[model samples]
Target: MAGTTWDIPSGATVKVSIIDSTMRLSNMPTTMLFDNAVEDFDHLDRIPTWCLLVESASGRKAVFDLGAPTDFDTYAPVYNKLMNEAGLRSGFKVEKDVAQVLQDHGVAPADVSSIIWRSEGLPVSVHSSHQHLDHIGNPNTFPKSTEIVVGQGFTKAYCPGYPTNPDSPVCETYFADRTLREINFEPGPAANPKIGGFRAHDFFGDGSFYLLDTPGHTTGHLSALARTTHGDIEDTFILMGGDVCHHGGELRPSPYQSLPDPLTASHYPVPAGLNITGCPGAALFGALQTSRGRRARDEPFVDPSKQLQEDYAASGRSIREAQVPDAMDNVFFVFAHDATLLGVVDVFPKGANEWRDKGWADTARWTFLKDFAPAAAKFGEEK
Candidate 1:
C-alpha cells in the first residue's frame, strides 16, 4: 500500500472556508461509487460540488474547484447526456456561479486576487482541481481578465475539446480566449518521503498549504492540505479532498478507527444508534444487482471499467489511514461531493476556519453511517 503519512510544518496555519456554490443533484447510483451492489440504485444523494477558498494570514487568497455550472447542459453537452442518462440533473438555481457566490459573501469578484489549484490574479485566473465538468463549471463565466490554472497534462489530454474533439466533455468556449497554465509536478521535500505516495507542491512556499497529486478519481486530479489555527493552537490542517471518494464510508472505519466495540458504542452515539459493530466499511457496498436478483459483487455498475481511476482498494486505504481519529483533532477532510457536510460545518460566508472550535469533525464523523443503517440492521438480524 502507498504510504499514508503527511508532513505538516509545526505551527503553520492558514484561513480556509467552504464555498457553498449552492449546487445540488438528485440522483446517483451507489454502485458507481462502491463495489458489490445493485444497479439503478436511487440514492437521491445530494450531489453537490463545493469549492474551497483559502486565505493566508498575510492575506494572499486562492480558490479551489468552481462547483457546478448553472447552464451545464449548454456548457458541456456530452456531460449533460451522460448525467441525464444516469438520472443526474443540475443542482442549483440561476446565477449560482463561483463569482456570484464570492460576491454574495462580501468578496467582490474583483477581490478574488487568485484561483489557487496549487497560488493569484483577479488577474481573474482560476485553478481547476480536475477537468470534470462540475469542477471546471463555466470558467467562461468569469470576467474577461480571468485565466485558468490546471494540473499537468490537462490540455494535452482534452484540448480542442467539444466541437473539435466531437466527443470531448469540456466546452471549447470556456477556454477560448483564456490562458491556461499547467503545474509541473517535481519530487520535492514533500514528495521525497511520500505523503500517501502523493507528489505535493507547496503552494504558498511557507508550508502553510500544499497541492497533492492524488490521481485516482480522475486524471490530473488534485487535492489540497491547508494548515489552520483555532485560537492559540497551530499545526492543524484541513484537507480539501477533491472527489477523493463521493461518500465518507469509502474512507472510514480505518485501521485507526474500526467500528466501535459494542461495549464502547455508547460513547460514540451515532453508530451506536445503528447498532453497528466490527468493521462496517467492508459490509457497506454499492446497490448493483446480479442477473439472478442478488446484489452484485466485484461488478461495475457503469461503463468502461469501474469509475475508480487507479487501484480502488489502495486509494481507500490511503485515505482512511490519513483521516484517522487521532488526526481528526488537527486534521479533517472536506470532500467535494459529501452533502452530509451541509449540516455539519459553517458554509462559505462563514468560514469553516473555526471548525475545531465547533466540533464539526466529531459531529460529522459518523453521519455517513446512517446511510448504511438498514444494511447494518440486516446484518445484525442475520447474525
Candidate 2:
C-alpha cells in the first residue's frame, strides 16, 4: 500500500453527487438508525442509492454505480414509505426514476466507459430477501460496451458486504456471474483490472477515475476514486465507504451501542449471532461493529484480509494495514456504506458550489502500508 501510483493525470478535480435512486426497504429497526452522531442518519436504512456523476480533472464524466431500472416508478409507495420513515426528503425529485437523471446529465451507458459495482445484483423487488432485484438494478439493460467492473470477490454475494456479515437482513443466496452475468455486456477482460499501488487504469487514464479494491464490505467490495489535484491533496474529496458501515453511523457509540439490543434470532447477523463452526469466539465478532471495530473476531472477521489472502484475487487478499498509496491523495473514496471518517463523501448539486466541490474531507488520511504497521502499533483508543 506504500508508493502510490501517480501515473494518473494531476490537477484534475473529481466530484460526486448522491442520486435518489431508491429508498431503503420498509420495517427497518430503531437501533440501526442515527448512524452518525458524527456521520449521517436519524434512522431508516441508508436507502441503497447511487452516486450519479464524477467529473475527472480532464473534465471527463464517469458514472459510478448505475441507478435501479427506470421502471421502478410503479412501486413509488414502498420507496416513499421508506423515505417518509427516515424523516428526510431527497434533494432530487427524480427519485421516481433515474432515466431523466441520466438524460439530464447527458450520460448513457455507452458514454459511461467505467462501471464499478459495489456488490452483485439483487432481485429484491421481485424476489424476497436479498433477492437479485432488491439491489443491482440490472446492467444488461445498459449499453453492452460499458465496462462491467466489479471487485475480486463479487461472486460470493450481491448484497455488498451483507453476505459477509451473516446477520444482514439480506440473504447471501446470489452469485456474481449467476445473478450479474445477465447484466454484463462488456467486451473486454473479466479478469482483475490493473492496479498496482495506487496505479489504476484511470479506465481511460485521462484522470476520469478507476476502482480500488477496498474489500471488507464483501470479499472484494471495491471503491471508486476520482482525483483532480485541486491544489495539494491537503483537501481532497475521498469516499472511503461501503456496506460494512452505513453513512458515518457506525463510527460513533450511541447508534452502534443500540445495535445489540434489537438483534433478534431471525434478523441476527450470521457472524454476530452464531458461533462459527471452526472458530473459537462469537461468530458475530467479525461481522458487526464493536466499541473496538466492526470485525468478525472468531476467524479474523476483517473480510478485507481474506481478500488480501486471495492474492488480491477477488480482492480476498490481505489488505489489512496495507497503506493506501500517496498517489491516492487527491482521490475521494465513493463507497459511503462504511463509516470510516475517510469514507462518507458530501457534494453539492452539480452547479451548487461557487467552486467545483468534488468531495468531503477532514478525516485523517492514514499513512501508507510501509508506515502503517509501526504507526498502528502506537495507535490506540483512549479507552
Candidate 3:
C-alpha cells in the first residue's frame, strides 16, 4: 500500500478559503485578479490569498498554500488605483491567517503538525517558487515543531541557494518522502524515481493529492493538488490547485509573449530559451549539457516538457493533466490569485458561516478535467 486509502470520516473534513485578495501589492502576479485597463494587456485574476485545511481520521490536520506575500497593501497610488479601477481589494492576514481559519473549525496553526506547500514560493515579491525565502516565508510563524514538506526537487534543487543546508535549521525534509517522476505521466506511474528537488512529487499515494512540477513560471516551481469526491447524486470531485496558473491570461499559453523580443525574454517559451540565466528551462538545459559532456558526444538531453503541467484548465493540474481523478468530477482550482476564478467563485464573508462545496463543477472548470479514478484502479503500486 503506498499509503492510507480515503475513508471519508464523519469528523474528517477539508476547508478552503481565499486568503489574500489584493492587486496593489508588488507586480500583480499573473494569478491575482487584477484587471488590465490597457486594451493591449490581459485581464487580472483578483483572487484572495487562500489557505486550505484538512483533518484526517487520525486527527492530523494540515494546511496548503499559507498566504501571499505580506507587503501587498503597501503599493503606490498608481498601482492601487489601477487595481481599484479593475475591482481589486486586499484582505489577507496571518494571525487571522491560519489562526482564524483553524479557530473557525476549532483549531490553530500551532495545532497543525505540518504545513505542506503546493509549491514553495515567497509572497508578493520573488518571481520564483523553487527558492526557500520564496516558500518558507517566515518559518518562525509556524509551530516550533511543525514540519515543512518541500516537494522532491524543490528540496534538492533549491538547497544550494539557501542560507544554510537543506537539512539545516530552517528548511528540512518532513519525511523521507522524495521522488523524480514526471507526475503528469498517464497510467499514474514513472521511474528513475528518487525524489528530485528539480522535479515534482506526489507526497502519499492513493493519488488523492500530490505535487506537480509547474515550470515556465519559475526554475524549480511546483504546484499542489487534492482529489475529493463531492455530490450525493453522482459523487463529483473538487481539486485544489495552487499556483499552476496565476490568472486567466496565464491558464492558456500565449504565443510565449512575443516570441522574439528581448524585453519579453522572461515570458518566452520554457524550451526555447535554454541558454538564459536564472531561468528554469536554462537549468534543465544546463543539466543536459553536463550529461552530453560526460557521454563524450552530443546527445539529446532529457525533455523538460515531460515534467511540465499539461494544461491549466483545471485538468492541467492533475496527474496526467488528462482526466480528473476518479474521486472527483468537479474541481475547485484554488489559485492564490486569479480575478476570473474569484469573480466566478463566492468568497465567504467574515463571520459568516455560509459555506458549501461551491466549486468549478458546473462551469468550464468541470469540463476541463477528465474522468479517470474508475480506470486508475489497475495502475497498481510499482517498485
The predicted structure with the larger lDDT, 2 or 3, is 2
Q: TM-score of each candidate? A: 0.77, 0.47, 0.48
Tens-digit lDDT track for model 2 on 120-207? 3322232122222223444544455555556554544334423465333233232333333212212355322444442233444444
Question: What tens-digit string does per-residue lDDT give for candidate 3 at 1-383?
Answer: 01212232111123333443232233333222222221112222233455555444355655665554344333323333443554434422333434444456556557876676556552222221212222333433555556665543444444433234422223333222432132332232542122222233334433344455544333334554443443454322234455554433223211111111121223322233233333323223223334334221122111112222222222233322312222223334455543434444544333101222443433323121111111111121110
lDDT for predicted candidate 3 compared with the true structure: 0.36
The candidate maximizing lDDT is 1
209-232: candidate 1 lDDT, tens digit per residue? 777766545546677888776446
Residue 224 lDDT, candidate 3, scale 0-100: 49
Least well predicted 10-residue stretch by lDDT in candidate 2: 366-375
True lDDT of residue 124, candidate 2:
23
lDDT of each candidate versus the true structure: 0.59, 0.37, 0.36
